[model samples]
Target: MSDQRESIRSNAKYLRNVRPIDPEEICEYVAGNPHPAVVRQQLREEAADLRLIEQDDGTFVPADDEPVSPRRGPVERFPAEYERRLEDLLVERYGPNWEDGASGDLLRSTVRRFKADYLDGRPVEYNDDVAAGYAIYHLPGYYAAIQYALDDLADRGLLDRTLRVLDLGAGVGGPALGLCDYLPDDALLEYHAVEPSAAADVLKDLLAETGRNTHPTIHRTTAEAFDPSEAVSGDGSSDGFDPTAPDDGFDLVLACNVLSELDDPVDVMQSYLETLAPKGTFLAMAPADKNTSVQLREVERELEEERLWDRDAVDFETSAAGDAERYRRGEVTVYGPTVRLWPGETPSDRGWSFDVRPDLDVPAVQRRLDENAPDDGEHAPGEFVNVDVQFSYSQLRLDGRRRIDMALETNEWAKMAEMERHVTERIDLVAAKLSRSLSGGDGNGGRGSGRSNPLFKISDGSEDTDHYAVVTTETALNRPLLEAGYGDVCSFEGILALWNDDEEAYNLVVDEETIVDRIT
Candidate 1:
């Protein structure tokens, strides 16, 4: 485990030169402590050089040498002052934890990590937050439900063997891949995914590497715009699709974790459901809330009208608060969130209460906070202070090995941009040291010297793997092997390793292990 940790750190150091400059870094490089006059001159030069290409292709390509390209989007060329204001706002909210101490290296490292795992490639989390989310969220069960639903449809021959499937809101393409794995080879399983996040890039990489039948046309675009009808003539190869023709649609349509964002989910479903062939099965997973209930009701109404409504209970509720209170009162923490414990195969037996806050909007909450600002740590009358957090819980159940892969999505790029400064600084410092070392002095000196590597670099970089430590006479699982600041990777093998290894010899620390083999 120590060797593996060292290896990851060494690799990080070696790849310092290969790190890409983040948008924030590019801004900083040009803004470089300039006087008012120099700043004006630079801004003038930038404006004089601006050029936009109006190409037939939808892509807005910028001039290659332009420092401030408008093609990436207006946000891409934000002024230095704007960035400063944004940083100040982040500091106010997240405190000093905002930028990892103003070093762009942290942001660069984050980007590099994202690129390495989820960006330009399939997110192969050896162990990380991406995986942990899957573990905690019980994503595997959702995949299982998809498979089961599809199998039920397939068994009845509802979808012909040649049917192609499109998975919407596929977080890491779990359901699409799982369905493919479960179906027979001759099923003609064509998989298409609709994801909106910049992580769509990651999904594409995964699709390419996994040897799956993926149509680039089937990626990145939203379902709203993915229709064949909307496709323009001469817009790339129809790629087995007719631009003017209605789709044969899909055999199975999987929509998970997507409907909640819509104000009119019913309309969205109605629009997309048309893409499914007649007698086609649509498996939808919502947050299991009132909003979800409304959407389900819409689906139910539509189904009943078509006489295809078949429902089953896939989840139950267990109150984490209720369980915590019981534990605090000197009772066993039972009847809490329906999580499977250790080798236990059953979910918790408890009813759950749903708390819906449709009235609370982000802007409204921010405004309220500003209006009722705490004066010297004292709350004003009628001030909105959250003494306790309110959370809604729903227990989802299914059967299968969970596929967990977590990578920082595109929305987090700005946050990661802040961390990039730290990473760049550290890299500069390391390079300086190396330069000095090669020169005359103590064999270590370059530009910025004597700085420690980022916390993540020091830690093992396995996001989809597990790390174990020896405890007493047994190897115990380090519940969360990685720190919160770092990435997390959880797996079934980690669970089994903890269960079987009550031994002392192999108690040191284990990074990764296969649990199925050990358990079986």
Candidate 2:
């Protein structure tokens, strides 16, 4: 069997650059004349290793070398195919009309119980009912949120075409499915998911809907227990694997919505960073709520600019030499969404920042579940709908790449660290717009008036306190603050910086005199 597999691989390698390698045609050349179906299955297993893409005609072709391009527009809706797939899974487990009866009661109570636990900062176990409930309530928003977070990497051509990815605590395949969809059709993906729950079942079913070139493996284990070196190694063992090898690491490591659930998030994050390729990215995300978002930033700051050591290289007996050797390993840096624009400064503010995108169109399953809620004095109109796309994400890299890398000159722009001195004075400043409009009819706190001023959270990575940019008057010159997307850096000229005693933050007032331009 091994000899036949090797013979098939040899033939495909020779024909890959020449033309599409058909499994049936290659089967004729194998030692024992294995069946074409067996050859096809063998090729599917080796596609990632051989860098081949399986086609619809049961043939294999070389994957394109170009990186996946950044998606240009907002993720308006979750794909219908995945929606139907989830419904199918629900039907298989619970009967048809799963939205009502005993199944409905179980799912509704499961969602409410977990939601309450999350609000109170308690961990919720991922049993079968909880997994299905999570899928119906959280899948659409999470699926939409990840693509937006990935744009911070894809925009700079950082995402690769031939990709190896590790997804830690990949609950119910929200981020996994989002990433598969984010890549172009020609891109080849080797996805390894670390999830130890019933959610893995749902994830496995949903991943089947991904493109043919995407090869997925679900490791039914926790993030801490899963060995990264063994997973990425060729022979599935870590005995002779080199942790420092360039090609033996994942191109992207995702820890979305999982850090807040870990006991030691910083140490776990550092461990994963050592397994990242030279130019790979580690994207950590959390819910937009205050506690989780703040905790995510806390983990990011704890690991930022800190050198990580190869655990095997450390000789505990020789402390001095070990410390000196470990210092040369690597440093973790924040890549984007949040900026470290100033050369020698880091924000010490509350760091409660989040991005709000256009709400996703509600999925059919969510609507069905919500509409069928029993009127036992507990059901709200839209209790089960999870369409809001609000999330907080931090992109970390060991390659020292930042989405916005620019030095702010003190003579030209006012540093956020020195905002106190410039308060009550019209000043020029540069900042990344971190949040969407926080005023008007939006649920976010602000005036309830229909004609309220547009307010945005802005950061320049040098503040010890929170800062906001308020557009009091709209004009052609200052309208960019309202038009620019989240994480966009805008230049504010002749803007009045005032201290808001009520909010305990600086509000940069942009009126007719202010010229706000988005720096591309």
Maximum-lDDT candidate: 2
- Per residue, candidate 1 scores C-alpha lDDT tens digits across 342-428 of 222221111111121112122222233334343545434433322211122221111121111123333321111122232212110
TM-score, each model? Answer: 0.32, 0.94
Off by over 4 Å in 1: 1-139, 209-217, 230-236, 239-247, 287-294, 302-520
The 0-to-1 C-alpha lDDT of every candidate, in the order given, reads 0.32, 0.87
- Per residue, candidate 2 scores C-alpha lDDT tens digits across 1-520 of 3677779889989999899999889988987888999999888888887888887788999988887789998999999999999999999999899999999989989999999999999998999899999999998889989999998888898998999899999999999999999998878999999999999999999999999888898999999999876564222334354535666678899999999889999999998888888889999999988888989988998899578653334443446446433334567889888887789899988888888889988899999899999998989899999899999999998877788888888988999999999989999999999888877644453323463778888999999988988888899999888889888899999999999987789989999999999994
TM-score for candidate 1, residues paired by index: 0.32
Candidate 2 least-lDDT 10 residues: 232-241
The alpha-carbon deviation from the true structure for residue 161 of candidate 2, after best TM-score superposition, in angstroms, is: 1.3
